[model samples]
Every structure is written in structure tokens, then in C-alpha cells.
Target: MLTGTVKWFNNPKGYGFIQAQEGTENQDVLIHYSVIEMDGFKTLKAGQTVSFDVGQGPKGLIATKVLPDNGQGAKVDNTEVLEKDSSLA
Candidate 1:
């Protein structure tokens, strides 16, 4: 698994891009909602840290088995995330 930060995510669009950590081959990886492993509403927020596996998609690099970093690396509170985005709530 690779660690990275979410550059941006569109809740309604159900897609986003992750900025890979320094020294990674891919600077950005596409992340789709389907790959998120969260139990509730699966969504990511900008600046959020995460770990995931990479795979080749039809378009290009994609993130799979995405897991949110709930430890020290994570900055945003999951509840705040849901509250901030009313659409996802």
C-alpha cells in the first residue's frame, strides 16, 4: 500500500485525485468512490491522508482498496467531513 494525501474530492461526482507522497513514481492517482472501504458514506476530503494500492485502469493510474489514515497522518475529523458536506450527510 502507498500513502498519500487527497488533493481534492467531489462528493457528488464520487471521484477525486490523490497526491502521492514524496518519491512516488506517480504524482497523482485517480480515486473513485467504489474503492473506498469506509462503512458509512464513502467520501474523501482535501488534505486528508490515506493509504491505498495502485492499479492500472483504462484511463491511467487508479487507487484501490483506499483506506483513510485515522492516526497521526489524518487531519480532518470524519464527523466534520460529513457535516461540512451536507450533500454527503
Candidate 2:
């Protein structure tokens, strides 16, 4: 898996780009919300660090199975908040 920081994301459109942290040769990878493996609405925030698998798309490189880094916790969805609240009791 390649590690990178989210360059930008369009929450409504469900697409974003990740800037690879490896080297200058590595270009930004396209990330679609569908490819994200989250339980609920998957959305990425700018500057968030993430790890993902690299794949070749028709246009260019793309990211798959994207996950937030250890230091950066995963974004919370409504379901998760409810689950947490229920667990408290």
C-alpha cells in the first residue's frame, strides 16, 4: 500500500486526489469514494494522511482500499456515532 496525504476532496461528488509521499516521480492518485472501505458514507478531508493500493485507471493512476493512517483516526459516520452511544449504556 502507498501512503499519501489527501490533496483535495469533493464530498458531494465523491471523488478526490492523493499526493503520494514517496518521491517526486509519483504523481497524485485519483480516489473515488466507492473505493473507500468504510462502513458508512466515505469521505476524505484535505491533508488527511492515508494508505491505499495503487491501480491504473483509463485516465491515469487511481487509489483503492484507502484507509486513514494510524495517527489519523477514520472519519466518523452517523451509524458509528449511534453505535458508540449505544455501547456506552
Candidate 3:
């Protein structure tokens, strides 16, 4: 997952961009409003930490399944967890 802060989201426009987290690449990711949790759209600000999946789009990588990754948030990097979540996590 890639992390970034919300650059700006024009709800009516149905899209937004995220400035990649510090120490990350110098590029921003595209985010479609629908990919995020509905309730978070309002509370999310210009600099909130979020994790997202990278999808290859016609334009480029698009952010999907965006969510607040708490400081202690563990990445989905463990095979055990992925297997469990896929089956019973």
C-alpha cells in the first residue's frame, strides 16, 4: 500500500489527488471519491495519513480502497494474515 495526504477533493467533481507521504516519491496519486469510505470524505483533510492500493489505470496508478492507516497500523505484508483474512482473519 502507498500512503499520502489528501491534496484536495472536490466532491462535486468526483475526484481528488493525494500528495505522497514525506520521504516517498515526488508524485501524487489519483483518487476517485467512490474509492474512499463515504463517511471519511468530510472528515479527511489536506494532510491526513491514508493507505491505498495502487491500480494501473489508463492514465496511471489510481488510489483505491483508501483508509486511515493508524500510526501502529500493520501492513498487509504477512502471509499468515493474508491467508486468514482471505479465509478467516
Candidate 4:
């Protein structure tokens, strides 16, 4: 999960771009307007807290599933263990 601010949105065209908040290689996220608010376009705006998935599109990193983060930050806790003997340490 990554946090970013909406740089710009094209309601008519049905797509937008977001400037990553921090700690990401790709700074911009490509978003399809269909992923925008269903009620109306007003639901989104620049500098809004948006959480999305970074996917590899035809070009590069594109924001696939997007949603408004209600203050609580996204959780990313995937753990992997490597087995080793004490003597190796």
C-alpha cells in the first residue's frame, strides 16, 4: 500500500494522476476515473489522502484499486523467516 496526493483529475476523460506522498520509486499513479467516486466527481480532489495498489500497466506503475483512507494508515506486515543454527550466528 502507498499514500499519495491527487495531482490532477480529468473527470470528463476518465483518468487522473497522483503524486506519491513518500517512500516510493514511482511518484505518480495513473487512475481511471471509473475508480473515482460513484456518487460524483466532487468526492475527489487534489491533495486528498488516497490509498491505491501499485500495478504494472502497459507503460509502468498505475494505481489500480483506489480509495479514500479515513485517517488510519494502511497496514503492510508480511513476515518471512530464515532458518539458521545458533552456530551460524
Model 1 segments beyond 4 Å from truth?
Answer: 22-24, 71-89
Least accurate 10 contiguous residues by lDDT in model 3: 69-78
Q: How would the candidate models be sorted by TM-score, starting from the highest?
A: 1, 2, 4, 3
Per-model TM against the reference: 0.74, 0.74, 0.59, 0.63
Per-candidate total of colliding backbone pairs: 0, 0, 1, 0
Q: lDDT for each of the candidates?
A: 0.81, 0.81, 0.65, 0.65
Name model 3 segments beyond 4 Å from true: 22-24, 38-43, 69-89
Q: Model 1: per-residue lDDT, tens digit, 1-89? A: 88899999988799999998853585689999899877667888899999989888887789877998873332345697677799865
What is the Å distance of residue 78 in model 1 from its true position?
13
- For every candidate in turn, the CA RMSD to the true structure comes to 5.4, 6.1, 12.6, 16.0
User: How much is the lDDT of residue 25 in candidate 1?
Assistant: 81
Residue range 1-89, candidate 3, lDDT tens digits: 77788787665587777787643466678887677754533334456678777666787668767775563321233587577789753
Which of the predicted structures, 2 or 4, would earn the higher lDDT when compared with the native? 2
After TM-score superposition, what is the CA distance of residue 70 in candidate 3 from its true location, in Å? 6.9
lDDT score at residue 48, model 3, on the 0-100 scale? 65
lDDT for predicted candidate 1 compared with the true structure: 0.81
